[model samples]
Target: MSVRQTRKYTHKFHAPTTLKTDSIFYRIFQSLPSTFFELINQPASLAQAYQFSSVEVKQLAFRIDGVFLPNTSELPIYFAEVQFQPDKKFYSRLFAEIFNYLDKTELINNWGGVVIFPNRSVDTGATERYTELLNSPRVTRIYLDELTAIAASSIGIEAVKLIIEPESTATTKAIEIVNSARQQIIDAAQQREIIQLIETILIYKLPRLSREEMGKMFGLNELKQTRFYQEVFAEGKLEGKLEGKEEGKLETIPQLLALGLSIQQIAQALGLDEQVVRQAAQPKL
Candidate 1:
């Protein structure tokens, strides 16, 4: 019997803390700190005076995904966390970590926090104890579903919203962001970075797609040349088990379809003819 192992997110101090979406959020904040402020209804100009960095609370059970440190002592430090999984103690634990970090640093600045959730539902509602803090402006909880609430004029903000877009329309939105990023971002290197960021988001959202297909979809000749895309493609190995029996491959048609893969793509990945994949997609008589 084959045992299926499920990867569960944990709060331990030393586990594999790299989440699928964590790095994407981290990059967006570091490259575009202005977008981080915009997410919390702050003026984009505030970013000009702050530098962002990820913090690790030494020997602690938690980590701050990102922190915005002000150049001057006048502004408070803001920490950011991307929480997709539901952990009832998330907020409490975050507070502990933030305090721990503050204790270590000699800088005497006030601090605030931001947590990004997919929506209101994913956030555990065990906040009765911290009602004052929760209601205060210091803690900003962002619900990604309500994209309209965000004044998404900047390309960075646009990329952040694109991460949570519905699958049916995500491709169209990704393409639009790519075009916008290319046209808006002046530097060639920055343009490629933003475009690659968008591509990375789509890859995480739609893992079933192969690199070739993704390149064609984005219409970028340099996409496949990017190191991130190559690494992700190798890890996913959509065409793994090339030697498996035809019947086994046939059984995967429905699963692939459910993952938003087209019949042609499925057949190509499985090394089977399109006709056979099409036939497998039909209802069994």
Candidate 2:
């Protein structure tokens, strides 16, 4: 029987993690460390979950997506702000929260900053307070589009391409990526994950593709017919049956042998050694 497939997300398609959006962010930070945030005391490392508090009494907090602790053995922490959208109040809220966190943490030392925008145009209407700060040596702002000229040099070209692709184009590109990755990845589990990611990115781009159509694009139907898939399922159903009877033990022996296990090896599998397996192998003797 054919299973009916359903499309996952029907509304508000934000870029999903399966699209490797977060990984793209990390790649950017890795390549342009100075542009996003200074390394501070962190020597070539990215802080995934950073913690900071604003006021001791209020307990203000900021959980930065990425942080670069000072490398020269400094207490001041450098925080990275990666913004994929054009939020007019982006800087306003960012500094307010960071300062609040500083107060709460009682962190009194040199601090560095970075703010990344998808493109130069997205840097809209910064407050005068932030304007001065943006100009400060301690803070750096990066525009991903501005760096497109260097796309060839980019380690995250796939991610950069994702930003530029239209919905239709994205689906096509995603299919190609999924196909390429499908061949490149040898591990079945990992290949499955990437295939799922491909589907997710597509669904995130176009909510209209029905799950059935999506399955066709990713070749899921073809995968279901593989011998490996059938065997795993068939074995799963027989698990309990195989565990119960003495006949089941006799039955398991030849199957194990058919699977290239020697009698001794099959004996080991059933928790019996050479002698027990040999006796089980003999009929009525």
Candidate 3:
């Protein structure tokens, strides 16, 4: 993936704790930069114009990571900062790093910055020295909790919102998000990434829940692709088992029964009447 160069996705938000919320946001940036652009009130298509990566300011003894560098020099480079905990020096350090990188780098592109906090309250960085920069278009500040007016549409944005969702409703919301991802995203790999990302977020949100329990909440989309499921579905016509004959179909009913499908489900799947499925399900003498 070319980092931030992806499509636009919009959705409303509402929402975690320690266990490194910043890293979760980092994962979001890696997997779905569209959500970041949406958070900044930019078109999701804009992500396609930028590449995201980290920059090392060797002289400064630090690295300025999480940057969105436009493909063309005409567009400004965006510095992204995710702040999960309150830091009094956050803005000072942010500006310092940005200016330092700008000074050393040959790229003369204009620069902007965005600071993302879990909520407004956690954004306690002292802005006195950099008030002008902080208040201008050069910088965009996002409080995830305050995001509103977005359509309930983009699965990408919805996944971002999962970070702050309350523990009580997180699982239910996760399931909904997983289903939406499966339905809306056509690309198989992207769909799996979204599903895994959602599951990762839930694992963080509800740490008490077991992985097995969490796996039950979301079908990973690989089941239907397996040979076992292929035979079980059998085109819902008892396909491939006992081919082209009623006896073959009847014979497979025992296999389906052994596989734990109920009589009605097997009947519906095989296009057989319930009584016939029941008779086939009976122990052979």
Candidate 4:
């Protein structure tokens, strides 16, 4: 008898902290593109005139966490970087990605850069070499910890601040944000999205807590009892049953991939195995 051989496969289950933070920022930008302009102290109206996206430099093998492209040729494009950890060579890498993007695109427009940090403590990246660029108006650095004073009035800004909130008080802050969302946001879907975002931020902040525990801490139980929640939950259940089909789930992989969801997030949201999602996400010849 001939000996049989089998292939072995290894799977990467979790996303790194940096990737998670990037995803959160991506979601915030997607749901509320205005928030980016708000953080940079620009007119929030500008967000309506621009579309946000994540860009990849295929040849150079670099990916920008986020980019805002203007609808007209007059406005400058913005490159956004969310740096939660310290990296000495961050500017070197950032400028490389920015210039490469400029070379690759045919669009002719001025450009700017925005770097977001939790606080000045983690903004340890060396800027000596790029001091001129850093000092120019083209670059904006936002520290989340310094924005707490404005969080009370702005739901989007409050959500951003929650990312750096301390463990002991994160839950309380989350509840306050949720309540504020209910009162301020008249749209039911928007309200749910804000609440869901708050839940997600807490999940990243308190990794040790189970989803059930986090849900309770955020008053999800009470929120779920609301009419809007019931409607959304019921619609979700119906959609889940329909998408439960293998073909339906496969069709969704590309859409989620386009939205910049990580394999882990796509798997969790679609009720599919990570390896399966990975395989589906791979490009075909």
lDDT of each: 0.71, 0.51, 0.70, 0.72
lDDT of 4 by residue, 41-89 (tens): 8887789999998676566665555899899999999988877777787
Leading candidate by TM-score: 3
Which candidate would rank higher by lDDT, 1 or 4? 4
How far off is residue 189 in model 3, in Å?
1.2
Question: Can you write out model 2's per-residue Cα lDDT over 87-192, one digit (the tens) per residue?
Answer: 6766776776566555666446677766656667767746677667878877777665565454233213444455446775776776676676556657776556
Which residue segments of model 2 deviate by more than 4 Å? 1-58, 61-78, 84-86, 106-111, 153-157, 179-198, 216-285
Ranking by TM-score: 3, 1, 4, 2
Task: Give the per-residue lDDT digits (tens) of candidate 3, residues 33-65.
Answer: 777788888898898898777877676566655
Compute each candidate's TM-score over C-alphas. Answer: 0.70, 0.48, 0.72, 0.68
Regarding TM-score, does 1 or 4 come out ahead? 1
Clash number for each model: 0, 15, 3, 0
Greater-lDDT candidate between 2 and 4 = 4
Model 4 CA deviation exceeding 4 Å by range: 1-19, 59-61, 149-152, 210-285
Please give the lDDT score at residue 202 for candidate 1: 74
| Pairwise TM-score winner, candidates 3 and 4 | 3
**Which residue ranges in model 1 land beyond 4 Å of their true spot?**
1-19, 59-63, 219-221, 227-285
| C-alpha lDDT of residue 16 in model 3 | 32
